[model samples]
Structures are given as structure tokens and as C-alpha cells.
Target: MKNLKMKAARAGKDLSQQQLADLCGVSRQTISAIEKGDYNPTVSLCIRICKVLGKSLDELFWPEE
Candidate 1:
């Protein structure tokens, strides 16, 4: 599934995909792919993204049931 929560959080923080990717040391396309559900990030990358977004892993990556 697409990671809309992460996208929303990024928007909430007024960050573009490029900005977030820079903060997380990744490419904009990588960030886009993650949001599009075409990429599954590594645990360390997930933590980095969560930290930059001021969110927890569960909040950003966990599926809602």
C-alpha cells in the first residue's frame, strides 16, 4: 500500500520529497518510490525518515488493521 501517512507528515512539516530525501541521505526518487509503495526501505532508513519527520516507526510504517 502507499504510505500516505508519511506523505502527509512530510507535507505537514512543509518538506518536499527532495528535502526529506536530503535529510535522510537518499534520492528524491527513492522517497517517491517509498511513498508510491514501490520500495521497501531498510530499517535504518525507516528510522532516519521517522526521525526527520518527528514520527515513530509505528506511526509511519505500521499497517492499520
Candidate 2:
């Protein structure tokens, strides 16, 4: 499924995909793929994104009911 939560958090921080990617030490394509649900990020990558966005794993990666 698409990661709307991550996208929202990124937008809330006023960051572009490239900006978030740089902060997370990943490529912009990786960030884009995650947001688009075309990629499943590793646990470590998820944590980096969470830290950069000031969000918890659940807030971003958990599947909502």
C-alpha cells in the first residue's frame, strides 16, 4: 500500500523527496519508491526516515486499521 503517512510527514516538514533522501542518506529514487509503494524499505532506512521526520515507526510505517 502507499505510504501516505510518510509523505504527509515529509510535507509537514516542508521537505522535498531529494531533501528527505539526503537527510536519510538514501537516494531520491528510494524515497520516491517508498512513498509510491514501489519499494519496501529496510528497517534501518525506516528508522532514519522516522528520526529525520520526528516520527515514530508506528506513526509512519505501521499499517493503519
Please report the TM-score between candidate 2 and the true structure.
Answer: 0.98
lDDT (10s digit) by residue, model 2, range 1-65: 89999999999999999999999999999999999999999999999999999999999999988
Instruction: Report the lDDT tens digits of candidate 1 across residue range 1-65.
Output: 89999999999999999999999999999999999999999999999999999999999999999
Error of 2 at 40 (Å): 0.5
> TM-scores for all candidates?
0.99, 0.98
RMSD in angstroms between candidate 1 and the native structure over all alpha carbons? 0.3
Give the Cα lDDT of each candidate: 0.99, 0.98
lDDT, residue 29, candidate 2: 98
- Candidate maximizing TM-score: 1
Query: What overall lDDT, based on C-alpha atoms, would model 1 receive against the true structure?
Result: 0.99
